[model samples]
Target chain A: MPVNHSRQKRGIAISPKNNSPVSLFFEGAKDTFPLIVGAIPFGIIFGTLAATAGLSFGATMGMSLFVFAGASQFVCVSLVTAGVAWPMIVLTTFVVNLRHMLYGATMVFFYKNLNPLWKMVLAFGLTDETFAVAVSRYSKNDGVPGKHYYNLGSMVFMYGNWNLCTFIGLTAGKAFPGISQWGLDFAMPATFIGIVIPYLVSKPMWASVITAGTVSILAGGLPHKLGLMMAALAGVAAGVICEKVFSEKKERI
Target chain B: MFETGIQLYEIYMVAGMALVTFGIRYIMFPLSGRLRFPELFERGLRYVPPVVLTAIIVPSVLMPTGETLNLKLNNPYLIGAITACAVGGLFKNLLLTIVVSMAVFLGAQWAFAMGW
Candidate 1:
């Protein structure tokens, strides 16, 4: 009865009854393009950095494929470079990736009617960027399927792009001495700002960000980048406390 | 380094870390039916920055020197970083942030090289 139940695999959208859903999936893909474009450069940098940190090419790409997690992989490289014990390296990576649990849980609710096979396939691929795209689509369209295809497609695309670019970067980083001095490293912060600024258009969010940024600066010198963690905790704590303190006020858009 | 014998110590550490990561990732699966978390937990999760972003950005900004701010005029990296944040906020563009920060830092270094 739904618009996408038929011709699910071919991506045909012309059926009078089934056009909307196929279009919606493509729509999801279109939305994810920026994220993939983002993946290319970010992946290149990760590869370059991992090599700079002394990881082998096989290890870096393997980490990307097996973990498919950008930041935690970087942390692993950092820990290894610093000669931290292997156990702690693993623990830190796990702790840093804890946010994925929330993502898996939230997206699962959307795909509730789908078979369990699709759920397992998707649960592993849902990263923040894909989750953002999927959540916005679900909220806007209301007819989105309870399946995880969009998340799967986006994640797989990004993962492939990243590994490819990372390999390119790894080769270049090794071949060219002092390559980092050329200033390609600035891409990382700029990317985060690009993402964060759009989210700060709302006032409460503005408060939350400023609080986090300032606190991070204050705690910038803490060991093991723990200050950064505290800053995040502080920022979100501020948001939650502010919301609770003002609960009695009438709700306004 | 560990072609065949990475050592039990290393194995335990890496495997332990892997387990921790797995536990964190599937954190919700075990609790889906067991506990009634307060609304605060849900609210906290929503308000928090995505985990990867927080770990990446926060650590780099706070501890670029490996453990300290490494603050000093000679540390052009810090200047470049701050320039990234300020210019990043004003323009809200990624390319501009990368360009401006790198340019300013390199420009400053150039001037310094010229005895400014």
Candidate 2:
């Protein structure tokens, strides 16, 4: 059967000796720690800003625990403060998070062999930070046995960091009202730069990054983060076209 | 105990945001795993992380307030991002990049405040 063929191919590729789930999990956690450092200020800013925006402690923390996405949470808080209606808030958050769909698509190739429960758990835990690290690992090893545990480690650690920081910010934000403006937020873009720079090894890749970043800045004023979604699509399209053209030229030569 | 008129409604909004956020995250894996994407489409997905991430990161720096592009010398964020990108490209170390970037950002902000 096609399922068996797929399973056998992936199963054979796994380095069984390297299947140390616990160590892999901790390694994932360790690797993700630096990213967590960046996220601390992000979560704190969200909590503090949400409180000042008139959200109750319970509501602010609830959003962090439940929504878990940083950008959307910030957007939700601002829109809520502006007295935007609930549907609009929901729609805006959803649009802002559509990039996750692309992440899921990229990961599904490696995740397909997993059982439903594992799929559900990892899917729930997936974030931009975890996905960036996890996808790199999966891309490196098509069949690293117990690879999902690494992603689990990253996700669980990030989830914990986000929640704890939110609590700290909510309770202590008044004492340090200027904490958000302390420029700790620089960690995020820096973290992202570190993540993206490693992938810039090809013409199509460089083209995609430059185009996406430029489009995002130019379209920054778009309503509800549609610019981000638009830039992602444009970048992907540009990458695909560039890949085809460049490959054809190389072949002709 | 300030009484905001929307306190009661915030709960529902929070729930709605949670549902939509989780729903988006949960929607794709199962379907994509079972289906077959065309060769070109599959190849393109490999570029998704860098492209989408840069798309998110760039605006956060250049347009921190989301209203205007601040390419000015006083913009610590732009300076910090450039510093971080250079460090990341040169060293490929996440922690050092963050640490140095924040240091530079704080230093630049301080200098700007001092009218330098």
Candidate 3:
């Protein structure tokens, strides 16, 4: 007779832990390498641009390491270079990274049952790539990926990618080799376009996009670069109102 | 060089910057503690992305001359970016979206270089 062991139990289907800590730390560097190949050049450009924009290498690296979002960092450096005040810099960063707030709200549904440390670490480790991966994994037919390890690995990889590439770019991110005549600066707007396209997945999403675009257009000239703040607030306001109205109507029906 | 009045230490400023960033990120941490946000607040939060993303990217697309308006006739980046958006919504693929938009940007810039 074949021996069938019914003793083993799967707790939420994550994984059997094997040398968890060391593995988690390096996993970030390894898995994110493919993404990093593209990201590094971008990081290098941000660093080089930041250097030209008058940030110290330490500050540049610190911002890249600690924060890890590209558009917001670019806006922060650009605005500072343009001589916007300190408060405006802080506000701009908030406005730009505000999207992550949405990511947090959605993740709470999946992660609420996790321990405090997991919640805190997941919150801290939140980034575009990690969140995108984690949320999809959490929502799919299969359960979340080795929840802690997957995110930890991706975060670590991304952190190394951003910092190291930034250092390299700072040292040697010349426009000459890439052929400045080629208009490589479009990478940013192009990237934003890439993100925005994925988001037109629903009615509310579409509403948010139009609202964000319109308000941003209207508030484009706010002083101290406050236009961005207004745009963010306006976009959120429009979408929220529409959603509320839609839901209320559905309930009434 | 004036290095005295009103200036902060380098390390302190770095810490301050990091603190400010973390503070902004942690703002969403309270979501759990509140069993429910003000009904209005919850609804609005749902719509935040579209509004904010538009605000973030529109200027990049439309405002090349700083404050002046440059439409399809003048700036090619805007045209390419818009096409990329259409491609993205239609195709629903990141790779295709990136490739299409990037090609638009490069092609337009190249044409400009060749003076065509």
Candidate 4:
């Protein structure tokens, strides 16, 4: 009960009995609102840039609706603008989105008992913001049932906001042609810092952040955004190694 | 004829992007209930978010233009990101951190443009 009390202070639900799926859904949306604010500029910039890059309205909207991944959509549009072939565009998309596989792997444990259809729906919305929010929720020891509604809530809210922001950007882009160049995309990195800084509580986590950050900057020139993947792998490996070393030291002590 | 060809090209490209994106995201779903990872692998999974997010945040903050490192004081991105880190660390409030950071970034941009 004390543990639940502390979690409740942190805004997690106290127990399953007090939370209905509908309330959980709303709570999820409310929690995700901050990250959604962070993403608004990103989605709008994508739309403005895609239009500037000469993508048809249909194509731009279709990519947002279908692909639904922010970073990959940006990469795809840039590649298209550069006259890259479709196959290469797709390849870049694949590479840009490979990090989602790691996200999916981390989430699979929580969702292993979920229905396949539910898993499918959630997977479509497993973006950086949604995953960040949902993983924090899932990791809490609050014994809440139907928490997937929370995930669904975050996903639907983000999905709708992204598309709507894209529409606004497309419409406003022609009117204010310089909107995309305003460097408003800084919101994303700012949001990421907020999300990540709270998690740097352990030696392994610090190792992971340092390794990944260094490797990414060092390999920033890699083609097709491969630097991201390299940095991620190096970071994870460093964390795992540090975790092992630290735990072994603790055992000896 | 030319119009139709362009439309077709766009369609093909969008479809290709959709397929690859969805495939990567959904690959682990079908295997979720069926597969179990090793203990070490499971422990390693905990680091994925911090690592991936940091990998993204670092380069984007340090190299906003993606062409060069901008560690100068005039770089709004670097200034704003550092402020965000400090605010987040102290307040641990997401919305407040974002708002304050954006304000700082905008102010920095204006000052730098004025030759400050």
lDDT of 2 at A240: 93
At residue A194, give the lDDT of candidate 2.
79
Backbone atom clashes (below 3 Å) for every candidate: 4, 0, 7, 0
Q: What DockQ does predicted model 4 obtain?
A: 0.60
Q: If ranked by lDDT, best first, what sequence of candidates would result? A: 4, 2, 3, 1
Q: Given the true complex, what DockQ would model 2 score?
A: 0.63
Per-residue CA lDDT of model 3 for B5-54, tens digit only, reads: 32344344445555655555555656567776576775565454445545
CA lDDT of every candidate: 0.62, 0.85, 0.64, 0.88
* DockQ of every candidate: 0.30, 0.63, 0.39, 0.60
Chain A of candidate 2 compared with the true chain A, TM-score = 0.90
* Candidate 1 docking class: acceptable
Tell me the spans in candidate 2 whose CA falls farther than 4 Å from its real position: A1-18, B1-7
Q: Write the per-residue lDDT of candidate 3 for residues A141-212, one digit (tens) a residue.
A: 544345566567777677777788787766676543443224555655665565556556667677777877
Tens digits of per-residue lDDT for model 2, A28-123: 899898899889888888778887888887788888888888888888877877989988898888898888887777777778888988887888
Cα-based RMSD of the predictions, in order? 6.0, 4.8, 5.7, 3.4
Q: Candidate 2 on B1-116: residue-level lDDT in tens?
A: 32234466778888988888777887887677577888988888988999998998899898877688898978999999989889888998988888898889889989998999
lDDT of 1 by residue, A192-237 (tens): 5445655665545666677777777787666555665677677777
Error of 2 at B19 (Å): 1.3
Ranking by DockQ: 2, 4, 3, 1
Candidate 4 interface RMSD (Å): 2.7
TM-score of chain B of each: 0.57, 0.84, 0.79, 0.88
- Pairs clashing in candidate 1? A3-A18, A87-B13, A90-B17, A111-A146
Point out the worst 10-residue segment of candidate 2 chain B by lDDT: B1-10
